[model samples]
Target chain A: MLVCRDLVKSYRNKTAVSGISLDVEPGKIYALLGPNGSGKTTWMKIVAGLVKPTSGTITYNGEPIGANTKRKIAYMPTEPFFYDYMTIANVGKYYQDFFDDFDPNRFEELIKQMDLNMTDKAKSLSSGLAAKLKIAATLARKAELYLLDEPLNGVDIIARDHVITAILEAANENSSIVLSSHLVDELEKIIDNAVFIKDGSMVLCGEAEKIRAERGKSIVDLYKEIYA
Target chain B: MFKLMKYEFRKQLLSKIVILAMVGILELMFIYGVIAEKANTVASAVGFFMVLAFISIMFVSFECAFTYSKDLKTKQSYMLFLTPNSAYGIVGAKVLTTIAQVFLTGVVFGTVIIANILFMAAKYHSVKEVIEVVQQFFKEAMQLDIQMDLIVSLLVYMLVYWILLIVIAMFAITLTYTFLANAKFKELVSIALFFLILWGVQKIAEFILPDLAHITSYIMLGATGIYLVLTALFYLGTAWMLDKKVSV
Candidate 1:
């Protein structure tokens, strides 16, 4: 389980994440629903140990997030993160080199399923293809937790389905997944819980179907209601 | 740690190739000029190649200073930081790789120079004449003793200075990224912090050994000891900042 308490992150000019607290239970797919500047990315980066919180502590299974926590957390950033010289094969090798849980055969299978070439350099791929490649590489890791920020941002509708299925296939009962995206309707089907944020604070959070039933609105409607 | 060093070396693949090629070409040119019995041409080539080697080594060290900052700026760093490596591990791997590189470059260049010296002896028939000229030059110009210990100390201090610059530069870079928001201010702080840290290191070293009045050897050895300690401290400080303060 991932737990954060009163997390606050601020820059010299502004605070990106305010006093927000939350828990991520194991064996569930969670949708971190928020628009731009809603602090979703900052929160996820904090959990991934890429960003340090100003005044709060984050723990995974009772230990503070550090190098050990990193091994169990796989993060896929919204931006293309591979070096320019890295090909698909090189990316797989890279993950295999660093991550003990990374399965190259699984990566190869995902690459085939996504119709991506092994010889393609990561920087040269189209945005959609790059997104697919990112998802494929990230999902191939058998980590305890996965935080995928904006996984569906640049993907087309056809590729979006493949991406969602890939994510679903990656999850198991021993792990948890947190996906941050603006594609609400698509995520509503797979997400078990939804956490809504607005302007660096949580507006609402609960089980996906329970919140929908109680509020008498879809996740998309709730997102619009919270942000707009 | 070695795994990280493997990738670090791989990253400098092109630069290494270019450096080695330059060394090989310069050595071959010097040998050819010697065999051709063109004394002035050989002298000019040796002078030019030494200058080239100096510039290239300085350039490589300059590049090493920014290696960590470069990794942080690129999203590719996510691949590295996400691994189970601590910030110390990450920083140590980089520093160690740089040390290994400098050592390798020095060894290769030194080998070529030794080969040339032996070849010169065989061709020109004059080790004593060469020694006389070098002794005269040192006595007249440098006014320093030529001894085995002195030579070793000179080389050791050179390597120590190289490492000090890199570690201090890294500390400055990481500090700038963590503390300052304005890009201009960040650059300014980095530059300012470098000089300040260097001055601080010297002052502290001097302050700790104030009673060593006239012993030049003791002063040199003492300063070198302080510098090694400072390097280790700076390495730890940089790693701490990366772990505790850096946002990415």
Candidate 2:
């Protein structure tokens, strides 16, 4: 479980995330929907403890996020996060070396399922393949929470389904997965909960089906109404 | 820490191998010219040293700078910083790897040069004469008491100097490269800003401190400690900026 209070992140004179708060529970897929530069990535980074908030606090299970909390949270950035020279196997090895909960066998199986060559350098892979590799690498870890930033962006339609499936397969009853993306339809069928963000603030968030039932509109319709 | 070191070691192994090979080739050329009794041997040896120094400095500086810059530009730093490791560990691994590379290269090159000198002397000059020349050179160049104990102390000092140089160079490279990597204007603006800051810092230090040119060697050792501290500060500052300010 995670909680953020008045989280704000700004760069120089521009505010990226302006005082957003939310609580995430276990065993649920929380889809963070936002347009470009909506501060979804910034909020995710803050929650993951990768970036310090300009002001506000983030707590995981009632304690401030730190080394212990970091050990429990797996974060995949928007960009391909591995070294160029690293092979898929080495990337798995890296996770295994850093996180005790990393399952190399699972990572290898995931790579194989994605049809990724274990010996191929990350830099040599196509963008979609690279994105799959990153997703596989992050999901292989047995962390309590998984924070994926735009895991489907630039991915082919077929690979996008595979990525979504891989992410779904990686989830467990005790773990929570937070995925951020603008592709609302792709996430519509998968995410249990949806958090819609616009201009660095949460416009709406609740159970995906219930929000639709209550509001008499789908997540996609609501997104257009909020932003347009 | 060990994991970090292993990763860095693997990352830098190729660069280290290339450097070693170049050093070995230079050593062989130096020895061959010396054994053949060519008058230009010493000149060539000195030239090789200059080339070696240039290569060493540039290779290490550029490699380090590019590594730091690429992390920011490519957003690979998020992977590093997001891990459950301390910022100290990340920066410390880079610093240690750079220092280790410099140390290994210096040891290999120095050993080759000394071995070549000894081999040449054995073939063409007496051991006593060689010892006398070494003693005279040390005495005249350093103006120090040239006892065995002092020789050991001098070796220690030289080792410290090598470490100091690597630390200072890495610190400067990381600091400049981080700013440049994150800044909007890529060409002259960031570079000019980097150099201006460096120049300003140097000027301030010079203005506040006594002239180092006239300082005694022993006093210079103390000053070198201050330099090392400043280098450490720069390293910490870099880590702080990367950890807190820079967005990936």
Candidate 3:
């Protein structure tokens, strides 16, 4: 349940997100499809309250995004964003310290499921393992909305399935999940809706199956048509 | 705010072990210097002051540079900024933690120095005479008027100065790093731009407020307050920029 109106983000003279508007409904997985520099990450960051819009307003469930709204949203960045010296246990403790809804037991369970050691420092993990750890840590929160940026990027094919499964398990009937990734085919089986963005604007957005049925094209075909 | 502060304290605690160990080594050196003073007072005093100067410089530089740079290099800032806490809370926690660490280290070092001086003095003089001698030495070494009120005020001023310097430096470093991280010519451009900005700010401050040297301590304190306010403004600016401008 997030709404963004006339959201525009620019750096100096270059416009990264040019006046895009969108609404996310609860209990649905929305796959944000965009090529590199399409402003998908910008939009997600704005919605997560991590970045302020240059000229726009974002409301979470009606009110403006603030501390209360932020408490309900969990954002996982695409980069490896943790202290080098932080072990999995310390990272868990960090989450526990910051977010009241963070479930330490769930975090440990996720770590075990991912076959990651709690004592291993985050920096020492491989990129795939790091991505898995990031995903697991993010999903351990009892947040109402989850914004994951390129969670599957650089991960092995086998690990991709694990990440997707973790996302599915983390998504509850009352919660909404927005994920951005280039792996469209993998997302096709799980995502309920697709929002296609190109050149900092939304080109296509609707129910995934309905768009295919109405347009006689899959999400991948639609992606090519919009960007190419 | 308390939660944020507690986390900040913990982070600093884990990272400052190396610094604490260095302080420990310096303490041992101070003890050795005092113990060997009878053989060579001038040499011992010179060695002690040299070590003191080295420790102070290293501590200040390390605290200023690495505290913020490590966060950027490690990308730990994402976790920090994305928390539900306010930017003020985050920056304030960092400033407070640095101040706390420095203050605690100063206390420890001061106690060690005092104990060493007292032990050396007791070897040659009566206990009362030793106490007087130690007091006199402190009064002269610190160059203060030796009043309780003056000492308390000086301590407070020093604490504030430490906080303001660390906070301003951190805000500047974090902001510069964030802007530079996504730039085309990252390392060189960032360093050049940072120095340019610093130069520009200094020039502006000088131009706006001339005759700064002639200002009284009270006026200097006021100016320090203004600097702190500016530091807070920079913290907010950095936070806004990161939230809105950052892509990665």
lDDT of each: 0.86, 0.77, 0.75
In terms of lDDT, which candidate is strongest? Answer: 1
Superior by DockQ: candidate 1 or candidate 3 = 1
The worst-scoring run of ten residues by lDDT in candidate 1 chain A lies at A77-86
Collision count for each candidate, in order = 0, 0, 1
> Where is model 2 more than 4 Å wrong at Cα?
B27-46, B57-66, B118-212, B215-218, B228-236
**Model 3 segments more than 4 A misplaced:** B13-15, B30-66, B69-74, B121-126, B136-151, B170-248
Write candidate 2's Cα lDDT for A1-228 as tens digits: 799988898776678899888999999999999899898988998888776788888899888866678889999888877876799888988889899888998898889888899999998888889988988998899999999999998788887778888889878799999999989888888889999888888888899999999999989898888878
TM-score per model over all chains: 0.92, 0.84, 0.82
Chain A TM-score for each of the predictions: 0.98, 0.97, 0.97
Candidate 1 lDDT by residue in tens digits, A144-190: 99999999988988888889899999888999999999888889899
Q: What TM-score does model 2 score on chain A?
A: 0.97
Candidate 1 TM-score over all chains jointly: 0.92
The residue pairs that clash in candidate 1, if any, are none
lDDT of 3 by residue, B1-248 (tens): 77776766666665467655765675666556555654465355547655764576447434634655655555576777678876556666666666666667666667766775567677656677878876788888988655665455456555555554555566556656565545564445545655665566556556655654554455456545655666667667766654445433
lDDT (tens digit, per residue) of candidate 3 on A167-221: 9998878999999998888888899999998888888889999999999998888
